[model samples]
Target: MSQAADLPAEAPSARVLVDFDRVDLAYDDTGGNAIEDVSLTIREGEFVAVVGPSGCGKSTFMKLVSGLRPPSEGTVIVDGREVSGPIKIVGMAFQAPTLLPWRTAMDNLMLPLEIVEPYRSNLKQNRAEYEARARGLLKTVGLEGNEDKFPWQLSGGMQQRASICRALIHEPKLLLLDEPFGALDAFTREELWCVLRDLWMEKRFTVILVTHDLREATFLADTVYVMSRRPGRILVRKSIELPRPRDLEITYEERFTDIVLELREHIGRIRKA
Candidate 1:
């Protein structure tokens, strides 16, 4: 993984933002639980990465955070409020771009505004303003001038950028990214990392990224949590002490590799356990 230089100094205060207390989740009508005894707190505007082996409920955790799923036990609170159904404050992008084939890049970016509130009710009255917002977000993600193209016409990376734009169009306070770059090649994935990093730096949204890529987590997160296999208990919590405003070149440095290796060891231990 290549990283940028000019590491950022750590922020002074680490106040809590999202809190998970002894949380346990099991799908309705399913006999088994997906996550158990999960407890962690993410600081406001913090970048937290959750990494684990496959089927360790990393995606399930995303659902919980976004209030898409209710816990069978324990509590999930964001900003001191308990999370109920479908939090309006969350923006999500997933493994696949999942952009509608029928919509052009700009239209796809405007999808959320068509459904989510404040904008939903005013979409007709505020179409011009909304379109302008989507256009700005597209440019930020390097999707400039591709707005008129349909999803099929854009490359996978371009489509993913549009998807992220759709997610952020409403400007939610929390961003839930579930392996959004998993389908991309290494080069494209790194490129998107910088895209996401710059967006996060500028927006300061609380982000909880669920991924299996240790290097990706190291490069983009303020803190990384490793989960054990199966029940998906959080087994390790490692603070990435590296300086921020990180670029792609920093990933090649000794410090970056050290953190990745340390996380690799923790995940290896979980696999063996």
Candidate 2:
């Protein structure tokens, strides 16, 4: 509900947060690019959503940003630094919760803190402080009392909350979510949407979410990008200027539907192409 400043009014020249300049990606033995000549810029603290057909390189884009795969040509830069390999400043979560079954919810949330940075080096000495932070995040996400339960004890939605808490435990600068709510039922998905919105509002971390849901993009992103079919390239760049602190009721508004329908039409055209 609080208003955080949106991305800068003008695009950054050298200070761009994330940039893909004529980026092309292909496997060594592949005959063509999975993503081709794609160029885009994401400013610091921006929430950008990418939508496209299956196998349209949405996942490939995530891999590229996380530095799991290097571009076959051109460049990718994040935080004014060239992406060379797996970036430590990035945290990721996907559709599946992927929580280790044996780990309790709080333990699941603490995984990143135990593995990353100053916390990792001081985990033994700072265990209590880190645990309190984890508990606080869980409470914020409505998972306060469930921290001691194992992943199997939680419902799909709760498990996903744990997964997101895990991703943010170390407080990375960039959050990469690849359809993190895709597997949940519609009601649960919407509930988590508010949870995610609140989290992003509180932290203001840059987010790159790859989702097939146009409504989700409209609800959460500052900008929505549509990609062409395989050998994917950005085909549309639409900005959503909807008033912030968006409620589920807003999805019923004409303005919201207009944006969703426009994005829908774009996706339909891509599917036919």
Candidate 3:
């Protein structure tokens, strides 16, 4: 892992990277807002998690941040700019790995660079450099020596690791994840948590994770936002103050369990309401 000094000197929390002010999003077919009066600020490099009842617009929030959906009202600002269309500075991964079946793991990781700007133009000239980067990222996620294998050849966890690497290969300023680990087995999911943790600690990019798992939120997020049922609203914003470079062992501690229970209670109340 790279030392902290390898990154910029600025404090990771020093700048506000995402701002949602009284935001509301409504679907015409649904005839009501999916998200309402949602207001929150996410600082640069902060790990934020959104948790709520099944239809509480947690995924809707991801869409807004990534510029996939426009708000019906209020502004959605990211990296100091009001989003007008799909922004280029964000990367996303979902519950599915979504790697191309025909492409090798290395080729899957290179897909974004082939489509996204600057790199796309320079790809032919910098192919070697990009391949080296892909290899490094694969190694980081324990996919070393598996670069030439096709997606179908890799395990579920390995495929997801490649999926995450593909999202990150572009080095975006913001990473949006919607239940990225929801499909994996419990042990693999926890292992990947540490993988993500190390990557974030090393790179200091902003992350917005939407998940149903309270323990995942509590264990990985700097702050966890609990939303109300439908027409979602921010019900609670709980900051996890546990020490950094968190280990899997911390999840077993009393403080960790308490925080998870608290988040669970908030969701339980929303579900019952």
Each candidate structure's count of clashing pairs: 14, 0, 0
Residues 1-273 of candidate 1: C-alpha lDDT, one tens digit per residue: 212231223544466678999999976767778899999888778888999999999999998989988898999998779998888888899989999999899888888888889889999998998899888899999988998999999999988888888888999988999999999999999999999999988988888999989999999998888888867788887888888889888999999999999899888877787
lDDT of each residue in 1-273, candidate 3, tens digit only: 101221222335577899999999999997899999998888888888998888888999999998989999999999999987899988899999999999999999999999999899999999999999999999999999999999999999999999999999999999999999999999999999999998888888888999989889888888888889889999988888778878999999999999998888777877777
Off by over 4 Å in 3: 1-12
| Global Cα RMSD, each model | 3.9, 3.9, 5.0
Better of 1 and 2 by TM-score: 2
- Indicate whether candidate 1 or candidate 2 has the larger lDDT: 2
TM per model?
0.94, 0.94, 0.95
RMSD of 2: 3.9
Looking at candidate 2, the ten consecutive residues that score lowest on lDDT are 1-10
TM-score, cand. 2 vs. native: 0.94
